[model samples]
Target: SEGKTSFGMSIFNLSNAIMGSGILGLAYAMANTGIVLFLILLILIAVMSAYSIHLLLKSADVVGTRAYEMLGLRAYGQAGKIIAACVVTIHNIGAMSTYLYIVKIELPFVILGLLGKEKDFGGWYVDGNYLITIVSVCVILPLALMRRLGYLGYTSGVSLLCMVFFLISVIFKKFVMECPLKSIDPYSNNGNKTLDPRVMSSHINSDFMATPFTTLMRSHNDSDFIPRFIPVMISSHTAHDCREAKMFTLTPEAIYSIPIVAFAFVCHPEVLPIYTELRKPTKKRMQNVANISILAMFIMYLLTAVFGYLTFYGNVEDELLKSYSASDTLILCVRLAVLVAVTLTVPVVLFPPSSSGFCDKWHR
Candidate 1:
């Protein structure tokens, strides 16, 4: 098939769309719903996401429509087209807003790290609005102007590479580093135990409804593998301790985790456009591209969640990176990588909104 985009490029584009800052929240999700349940939800979400994409591809093939707006038009007439555009526009706007927020919050930290200045510069230049403007002009605007989506494959590839570094760093820190590393002074040795209980916890809050379902297990002890798993509860604790605490309770916290996972897997809007650009535009081929992308994200998500949860069992923070000591140089590098990834991702997200407008104009 003489498709415009190679399979590799297509996978990169889709994967870039699939993986976002939502990965940062997976650890917190796991902390709320124990390691086993978290993995189960992760797998279930991944499968459902992939299946949805498959259905989308099959439908597109049936109607010979490559644009989501067009697909809506075929099924629901003018109303469908308008609704699709509205939905895509709204979703893309929300996603871009998140990336904008990520850039606003992270750029200053990256700047400080580069300058080796811990305290704020005490100037307007360090202000988040100023940083967002600078990034918008210098980084995002140029990419958003590109007329072709294929060119973004390179940026997407680079962005995914940066995320890979973030993932690797998380794994490295989790397994290779000791619990009470003197460098991370917050986690000092306890009175009796060599490690602080806050460092790892076995306690899950009772506020949640507990379940006996078990799927997988991993703990601080590399050699120990136990199947006696219970649903985990998410709560804020002043104490940072690692205990073998297991409580299975279904609460609002578990319900809250769903949006993050859903947000992480949200790439449906980008699917049809990518399909249009694929080298072989067969439904099977597009499905293959999506499957590869989803599988890649699934693995990365699991690894990040498992390692992060293992590192900070019950006391996992909302932002996984926030759970770590800011002073850690290694973490600082990962922070920079995440900053770059999210910044570059702005244009990729902006594509859907722009395309929706363009298609609407052309069709009209």
Candidate 2:
């Protein structure tokens, strides 16, 4: 009965919600749980996330309650409503904080890159405290002020494009370029030796399973038949022929990676609203939207993790972009991409909480 969102816009909005700052950590997740296991976990989480959305939609359809908090009220009365509201509030607050934190830490770098000033500009724009505030006022506040959820889809599409740029950059950097930091690893002799291309390619070919993404459809543990595949970093400056590559051990600590991946795929709070706003408003179409959105994110997440892990190997940092040397111009653009994407994504995340509160007040 309200303004309806078209199928494509719905897909873009949901996908934007599904993809977030959480993706930057996925390479680290892959590092913790080798390339093989990371794919498995990603698929598993995506399947579960999609199934959960289906259940939420089915519940809403059967109960005739489209809002998440309202669905909570239908299922469990006032207590359910309160619990749902609080969960949505807490979830959105955490998400908003993370988005703001991304702006805080990354905005200065983006501005510095644009200004061509490698150093701080010594003003409010450079300060982490004020940077987020400035971005919130200049960027997020306008998007958040929109009266309808569907109106934000245009910005959401742009945000998704930013992430797409990031994914492309990771893939491009992996094949076409070498990070200058590779030659500068302190562990390498003299910090000036170039990796022999032949030696590097040989190791990449030999340990094909564990390195990069050639082994995408395969799985192996240290205890598996192949066992103990190490990533070699060869130094051309050395008279010695081959250096021992660092073996990325399959550790028992894979548990830490699951939550972050799970966090990345979260779009439950926004699901009901999107479903409600769908033009046809059928359960089947909404389910398709959820599936398609999750599938798109699945591909992006796996690619980001695979390429990023391949690029850094055992040295993948918590934030994949941070793994790049600060001076790399290509990486600076990718950083800006993430900042813009997250900046726009904040309002999409913020909408559910604020709208849910309004719905609660109206119900009263």
Candidate 3:
């Protein structure tokens, strides 16, 4: 395809991972740094992404090798070969959370989707690394045997298609379905389990019903109050102009403090890998990829954060995924498609790390 490693892959990666829980992390990110600080952090994160690309380009020029191998030369000299392996391994370890989150969410669904009519795997608890070990043996082992990154090329195309399906479903569902994640409730009786009682109650606090309830009041004036609020407080005219800027406390005594709460799940880490990845090999592509990617990510962040701010801003515990959970059938269908795209792309994002980790562990 034209996009074998082109703009399509960049969009697919950004669409898949840039989203997910990252939007929720950002809700708190804003709450942590405030809107101004949040933007600063975003630019810094984006810079780091750009820098990674710059580093790879420079490295590739020196010894004339791919980014992965270049890391080895930078670190190892003649041992660059070994260093490269270690670098890949370390990268994967950092990305372990992404791997675990995607698998846990998707694998459970697979077992249920294929067999939901027949049975549920919820009861299966073999304990320990038994599951991980088993999966590595049954699943990882086969994929590991593959020859190279090029070997997996076709799957990447499939993953992009899956990503498009995901985008379409969510966008369509948003307009059609009436439920917002906050209002949809399941009933619950046990501490261990429960279902929303919304079905029984005549009253529902639908976001549709609540958006007009009065937007959370941000003061038209931001100058004086911002200094006392937010964690990374700074002197800036922008902060002053941001009327109704939220005032977050910086005191240790403010148990369950707002600034800390905001930064808690702020997902700044995701942009790091993506920025570098795109910069390294794909830097020469159309500028549209960069502009479009930034715009999409920003818009995606805004919609979900608004929901989170409205839904759980003060209560804590990020609301990105929680809001998705609120979406009705159409939304649910979108969620399902997103789940598939994320699951399939797992190997692509995690592969470098997995290869590096396997080699490093093998030597040590």
- Deviation in Å, model 3, residue 102 alpha carbon: 4.5
Model 2 ranges off by over 4 Å: 179-249, 357-364
Task: Give a tens-digit lDDT track for model 3, residues 1-364.
Answer: 1223444565555444333434435555454445554555555555554455455555554655444654465667748766666655565455555655655654544444444333444455322234445555665556545534333445545554654554455455445533221332223232222323223233332212222221122346843221111111111122223223344433233333233333322222232233344433444442344445555655555554443443333332443344443324444454555555544445554555544434446434
Candidate 1, residue 229: lDDT? 36
- Models ranked on TM-score: 2, 1, 3
lDDT scores of the candidates, listed in order: 0.77, 0.77, 0.43
TM-scores for all candidates: the values are 0.80, 0.80, 0.52
What TM-score would candidate 3 get against the native?
Answer: 0.52
- Write candidate 2's Cα lDDT for 220-319 as tens digits: 5633232123333322322221222222446565677889887878999889878878898899999999999999999999999888877766556788
Off by over 4 Å in 3: 1-7, 10-21, 74-81, 94-97, 105-283, 286-299, 310-312, 323-335, 353-364
